[model samples]
Target: MTLASTLLWGVAHLAAERRRTGLALMVAHVLMLAGVLTVFTAFSVDLLSLAVQPRWLIVLTVALVVIALAWTGVIVWSFLLVRPPRSDTVGRLLTTTLTIALCALVLAPTAYGARLAYVSRDVVNSLFSTTSSTPVVAEDPWSGAERVNFLLVGADAAPGRPGVRTDSMTVASVDTETGATTLFGLPRNLEQVRFPAGPARDRFPGGFTGSVPDTPGLLNEVFQYAEDHPDMVPGVQKGKRGPALLKQTIGDILGLPVNYYAMVDMKGFAELVDAMGGVKVTIEDPIVYGRSREGLLPPGTRKLTGEQALWYGRSRTDSDDYVRMGRQKCLLNAVAKQADPMTVLNSFERLAAATKRAISTDLPQELLPAAVDLAQRVKDTRIRSLSFVPPLINTAYPDWSQIRRKVSEALSHRPSTRSATAGRPRSPERTPEAPVSLDATCR
Candidate 1:
C-alpha cells in the first residue's frame, strides 16, 4: 500500500503546475527509490562477510537506523509542507490527513525492520565479543571438500572446585559438501591417550598416563592437567592452553584434525535448554536424578525442561558413565534436530543470553556463513555416532588403531537404515549399536 501510494503521489506531484511541489515530489521519489535499492542491496550482498569489528557493526547498525528515521522524517516533511495550488480548505485538510496516514504506513515497516536489524546486529556483536581466555588462530576458509571437525566439550564445574573437568567430550565432524556428520564420543576413562609428536608427546612418551584418584589416567583430565601446567605444552597460547592441548590430544587419538572447540559449561546447559523452550526426546530407559533416587524421568517420548534435560544428559545414578555418554549424545541430537530458526527466534533473547554465558568457542566469526550452510546440510543428512565403549574397546586400555579405524569407517560409509529424523521410532537393529544413528537414539 505504501509503495503504491508513493508511486501515485510521485506521479501527481511530477505533473503538478507548481515548480516547488514538483521539485519536492521528485526528491521524495528519489528517496523512495533509494530505500528500495537499500533493501535490494541488503538481500544481494553478504553484508557480514566484511571483516569488521563488533564496534563497527554497532556503528553501522546505528547509522542505518538513523538514516531510516531521517528519511521517514523527510518523507513526512515533503508531503506536509509542500502544499498543492488552488486547493480548498476541506480538500487541503483531507490531503494532509491522507498524507499522514500514508507516511505512517510506510514508516511502520521501515522502523520495525530497522529495529530487528539492529537487534540482530547487537546479538551477533555480543557473541563475537565473547573471547576465550586464551589466544587462538583462525583457520583458512573451508574448501568444501575436507571434513570440518568441532570438539564439543561439556565442562562440569562445581562450586569450590579447583578446576573444571570436561565430563563429556565428542568430536562432531561434518562433511563439507554433504553435511553428513559423524560424532565420535571419547570415553572419559580412556587410558594411554597418545599426544601428537610434539613437546607434549616428549613429556609423556608413553601417552597421557597422569591420573587423580577418581578418574585414573582418564582422557578428560588432560584438559585440567594442561590448564594447571601450561609449561608442559611449551609456547602454548594464553587463555587457550587447555583447549589447545586437549584438541591436539583428541585429534591425535581420533586421527582427524580438530578444526575448532566449543566448551559448554554443564551447569549452564539447563539454561540453554530453557532458552530454546526445551528439547523433545524419546527416552528409552528410566533416567534417575538427585541423591534420594526419587527424581525419576520415566521412559517414553517427552519434552524436557532445562533441569530435566541436563540430568537426562548428565545423570548416571541408575547407570554408568558410558551409559550417560550415550544419553548425552541422544540429548545433543535432539537439540540439534529440534532447535530450528523459528524456535530460536521465538526465544531469541533468552537463547542468546544463555549461549553467551554457557558457551565459548574458537571458531572464527568470518566462517559463520559457511558454518550455517554446513549446518543446514547436516540437518538433512544422517548423523552417525561411534563411542569407544565396552566390546568395541576397553576404556582401561583402548586400542588406539581400532578406535581410529571405526571413526574412519563411520565417516566413509552410509548407514544401511533410512536417514533418521527426530521423534521417530527406531528399528530394533538400530538400538545403541556401534556407529548408531543419532536420530534413532534420540527418537
Candidate 2:
C-alpha cells in the first residue's frame, strides 16, 4: 500500500523469481520506478477522466497508481536481475537505461491496450441492435419510476462459428436513481418472438421445447424461416437471417429499447475464464452427464473447462433449461465477480486477440473507455438478478394453453400464470419470449 511496502514487495518478488540481485538490479529497479511515473502520469490522465473522488483524493489516487506502476515496473526488471550478468557497471547502466526506455516504448502498448478495451466494449454494445443502443430498460409497473433495462445476449454466432445457438440470455434492469441492476434470465424455450426487421413474426423457442432444434440447428431454422416468411422475423437478410431475428426477439422482451449486444464464442468463454485464472463458483447441484455434450462436471467449487463450463451453463436435464439458464446467469455473475481486473489488464493483449477472434459487438467504439470506467465502479450491490423462465415451465404442467397464458401475461407485465399451479422459485418471472422489434432492437 505504501511506497516502501510496494518497493519492498517488488524487490522481494524479483528476488524470488531470480536467485540474485545486485547493484545493476537495484539501478534497474530505480529506473523502473521512474518509468512508471512517466507512463502512468501520461495514461491515467486520459483513461480516468471521470473519477468521482474529491480533488485531493483524486490526486492521491493518481499518486498511488503511479507508485504501483513503478512497483510493477520494478517487478519486470527483476526478471533481468535473475538472469546471468545483465552487464558490467557500464553495461548495467546501459541496460537499466535501455529498460527504462523500453518502458517508455511500452507505453504505446498501454495506450493501445486502452484503445482495444474501449473498442471491445463499443463493438459489443453496438452488436445488440445496430440502429441504436438504449441498453438500460428497467421498470416495475408496480414501482413508481421506470427501471433501466440492458439487453444482455450471448450468441455463439461469432464469425467462423456461424449458426451457433443463443447459449446465454438475460435482461438486465437497473433503477437509474437507485442504481439497482436486476438481471433476469430469458428462458431459451418459451416460444414466439416477433422480429421487427426481417420477419414480423419471428419465433424463438423456449429451451425446454423437447422437439425444437438445438441452438445450432435452430439458428438455421430461424434463417430459413426468415427466408420463407420474412415477415415473421423482420429485418433479416436471407443469407444470414438467423442472427437478425434472434437479435430482434431479444430486443422486444427486455422492454428497454435494445441498444447493446455481446456475443462470445465457445473458445472466448473458456479462454476468458482461464485468463482470469478460472472463476470460483459455488455449484449447488450435481451436473449429470448428457449427450450432445456429455461433459463430466463435478459439483462443488471446481474450475470448469470450455466444454465442461458450457455444459454446466447448458445443463438442465434435472430442472430443464430454465434452471440451466439460471446457472448460466450465475456463471456470468461469477465471471464478473471473480474477474481479475489486473489479469484483464495484464492480459489485455491476449484478451484483445481473443476479442477479435471470438466476440462480435455493435456498440460504438468511442464509448468503450467510459464503459470500462463504469464497470470498474460497479460493485455487487449495484446489481440485482431476475429470471425469464416463467413459473409454468418450472414444472411438468406447462401445457400449451397454460404456457400461452403465461406468455400473454408476461407481455402485459402481469403476474406469472403458473403461480396457482406449479411451485414458484423465488425469481421474478420473465416471459419465455421477449425479442426486440427491429425499430427498437436495431435503429
Candidate 3:
C-alpha cells in the first residue's frame, strides 16, 4: 500500500482507512499537477524565460525541498498505519529497510534540483547584480528599441603585462523583434579612434594619441589608457572606467549607441571553453603561435582543447589579424551552436565558475530574462559579419564617414545567402563589400 501511494500519492492513506487524510492528499496532488500544467502551457514556447528569473529559481528550490520532506513523511506515516500487525520480526525489519531506501530514492533527484537552482542563483548574483549603473525598463526592456547594440571584447592581461589590452573588439547590433544580429569586427591596430561627448573627448580632441611614440595610440590600448588616467572619466566608476571609455569611443566610431559591454579575460577564456567540453572548430590552414613559433594546429574538422582553441583563434604568426578575425568568428559560432542545454546543464557548475571568473559586464540582473529569451531567438536565426580589415579600410588613416556608411548599409539590408566561398579563405581579387551570413561562412 505504501509503494502504491508513492505512485498515486494517496492510495495508502485510503487503504489504511484514513478517509479525511486520503482525500486531502489526493486534492493537494491534483492542485499541484494543475499548477504545473498551467505554467508549462504558458511558457512552453520560451522555457528559458523561467530559468532566467532569479526569484522563480529561488522559489522552486525551496518548494522542491518542502515537497521532498512532506512526501517522505507521508510515506513513513502511511507505512506505519498500513503495515501488517501480526508480521514476524524479520518481515518487519525488511519492510522498514525498504521504506528507508524508497525515501532516499525520492529525495535524491529533488535535492539535486535544489542544488542546481541555488548554484544558478549564486552565479547570477555574482555576475549581474543590481549594482549596475544602467537603467532597466521594468515591464518591457526592449520597448521602442529598434536595435540593441552590445560591445563584446576580449582583453588579454597576461602574467607580466602591466595592464589589460582589449585585443579583440566586436560590436553586435541585434534587431529587437527579429533577432537578426550584425557583428562588426574592428582590428586592434586601428588608429586615430575618436571618443564621444565626455571628458575623454575633452582630453583627445584630435582622436586618441598615445602618450609615447613607441606605444602608438591604437584601438586596443583604449582600455588601459582610461585606467591609467581616471581623472579624464571622473563620472565613471573606478574599476569599470576603462570599459566605459572603450564603449563610448567604439559607439562614436560606429555612430551607434553601445548600450552594454561584456568583456572576457583571455586567460580565463580557456577555462570557459574547457567547461563546455571544448569547442569543435573547422580549421582551414595551419596556425602557429608562441614566442618561438613552436605551437601549430593543422587543418581539419577537430574538437580542440582550451589551449589549442585559444591559439587557433588568437595566433597571428603566418597569418594576420584579419584572418584571425574570421577564425574567431568561426570559433564563436561553433561554441554557440554546439553548447546545447544538456551539455551546459551537465557541466553547469564548472561553466558558471569559469564565466564569473572570466567575464565582466554592465548589464543589470533584471534584464537577464529578456536577454535569455533574445538569445534563444537568436539561436534560431542566422548571424551576419562585417570585418574592417585592410584593402576594405585603411587602419592607419580610416575614413570615419565611410566606416559609418558601411555600418548603416549592413544594418539596413538583409544578410546575404550562402556563398560558394563559405568556409573558404577570401580571395585577394574578390570585391570588398557588404555583410555575409556567419552561418554559411562558418559552415
Output the number of the TM-score-best candidate: 3
Q: Any residue pairs clashing in model 3, and if so which?
A: none
Estimate the TM-score of every prediction.
0.75, 0.54, 0.90
lDDT of each: 0.72, 0.49, 0.81
lDDT tens readout by residue for model 1, 1-443: 22332653344444334557657656765886787688569753334443124454566556656655665554565554454545578866777787777667767766665555565666566555445333433432574235789999999866565678888999999866567788888878888888888877888898787754644667878888887787767887666788999999899888889988999897688998998888898888888866467689998999999989988987888699888888888788789778886897688677767877888877766566566656767878777777778878888788989877777666656444333432234333323344543323556
Could you tell me how far off, in angstroms, the CA of residue 268 lies in candidate 1 after the best superposition? 2.4
Per-residue alpha-carbon lDDT of candidate 2 for residues 171-211, written as tens digits (9 for 90 to 100)? 55543333435455555544443334332432433321212
Candidate numbers, best lDDT first, in rank order: 3, 1, 2
Ranking of predictions according to TM-score: 3, 1, 2
Between prediction 1 and prediction 3, which has the larger lDDT? 3
- Give every collision pair in model 1: 133-239, 134-238, 134-239, 134-240
Off-target runs (Cα >4 Å) in candidate 2 are 1-148, 156-162, 176-178, 193-199, 202-244, 251-256, 289-295, 373-380, 390-443
